[model samples]
Target: MKLLEIVEQLFAQYGYLVLLIGLPLDAIALPIPPGNTTLTYTGYLAYKGVLHWLPAVLSAYAGAIIGMTVTYWIGYKFGQPLFDRYGERLLLKPVHMERTKQAYQKHGNKLLLFSFLMPGVRQFIGYATGIIRVPFRTFALYAYTGAAIWVFLFTGIGFLFGEQWKHVLIWVEQSLLYITIGLGAALAILVYVKWRKYVLQKKATARAIDR
Candidate 1:
């Protein structure tokens, strides 16, 4: 069966349970139901009066946060050893970790807020944050806020579009490639700007000290 059909069946049989459980699993990177599709479907259901908007949105938000939190803890507790043992097969090296850590430090914790909007990135950000030992409080603040916004965005789309949510999904899937490329270019520019500013500041400070 098609994933959307399966999701429809699940929602029919399980109602809110589908969102509560399915979303968390998706957040953890399981390929069952895509998170955006699920949220959009939930929104459509709300529009159809099959589900309540508040509960549907809440369930999705909670599920995403829980899944990410669990993944983060797993990464914190076991990521290093597993990577040490099996990372070569995955082409993950120590240098990659070091570079990621440096980037995280330079960008600060707020960078995680956008992880959800990036394809294939939401699944890894939680794990990476944990492996890098980011404080849980900071992780929760940004990650949870991002989750809420992401959930609302998709759900609202589904709700507003009614039966046409599928078209939106298709558009999103196609546009994701362009969006990812744009985001990558923007990030590169931001990093370059920050680096340039830092260098200029350091040069000025050095000149002052010499004087």
Candidate 2:
């Protein structure tokens, strides 16, 4: 069957399961679009008066936090060695990893709070947090707070914009793509700038010693 047909059936028959499973799948980079499509379809259902908005929103919120928590655990467990070996060729470059490390260095625990809201930054932040051995209590505090707000905001969008949610979904997906691209470009620029500064500083130090 077609993909849309499957999405429709899943929304109709197993919306809650989608909420539960989709979150983790998306967190793990499974090519799923997180809760965007699911929430939009649920909104459509709500407009038909067949679904309750509150339950769906709450379920989605809880599911997102749980899913992110699971992903965080996986990162904590096994992400370091794998990333150290393979991150450069993939999305997580050494520079990107260093950027996240810098954020952790500057902000201490607050980077966790902001990571979820960030597009390109969150995945790396998760892994770096693990490598740095952020305490579970601190990690949960920042992660859950960010995840809660993230979930509630998106689910609330679905609940409030039930009828026109298709437009919202399209806009959100497009916006995310743009944001991710922008972030990647920005990271590249920052890496170049830092490298240049470091080279300049080394040259200055060498000149001073020569004198």
Candidate 3:
């Protein structure tokens, strides 16, 4: 909770810059200030009129994007060689990397969205995606969207609950897995529906073009 107080203090002093800088650091697997607490506190500040709601959200979103991108590039540049050389000593084998790539391919990138919700995995996912060479466009489509949803959800909780937001974080941490699972299912359904629509539209366009 002292850390939570520290986050509030940082926001109080520097305003939106805290979210802008801290989030990127957090994404890069640095806890310059942790992400979840900072987001909730940002929303709380917004609720208290210390910071503008919309700008706070925007700052957090931008920061998260910057962070994820930085880590992804880091992994893209050096992760393969670094991991390959040291992984076996740590019990990680080539099959594990292959399995990761296969999983990403099978999921068609929706999995990347929810990976942001998971704490440990979230930190490393960008690196993994980069190391495995997920195409930049596909990675951006999912990663950027995921960052928006992630920032809004956590910050919104702070805005909605105000003073009670910290207490709620305890519950959130305990339930994060369930939350992630629920979010994953919802995202999967949404993706399926969108894909179905796209397929139908393509079919219709083809039929018209043929006729």
**Among all candidates shown, the one with the greatest TM-score:** 1
Clashes of 2: 0
Give the range where candidate 3 is weakest over 10 consecutive residues by summed lDDT.
113-122
lDDT of 2 at 8: 74
Clashes of each: 0, 0, 0
RMSD of each: 5.1, 4.0, 10.2
Q: What TM-score do all the candidates reach, one by one?
A: 0.81, 0.76, 0.77
lDDT values, one for every candidate? 0.86, 0.69, 0.86
What ranking of all candidate models by TM-score puts the best one first?
1, 3, 2
Residue 206, candidate 1: how far off, in angstroms? Answer: 24
> What global local distance difference test value does model 1 have?
0.86
Per-residue CA lDDT of model 2 for 1-211, tens digit only, reads 7544666777667767777777656555552544556656765666677777777667767776776677677778887778888877687877776776676667757656856556655555655677655777888888878777766656656667877776886787678778767866987899799999999999999999999
Better candidate number, 1 or 2, judged by TM-score:
1
Question: lDDT by residue for model 3 over 94-176, one digit each (tens)?
Answer: 99899878878988487678666786667888988899989988889999999988898899889999889988877886698
**What's the lDDT of the predicted structure labeled candidate 2?**
0.69
Clashing pairs in 1: none
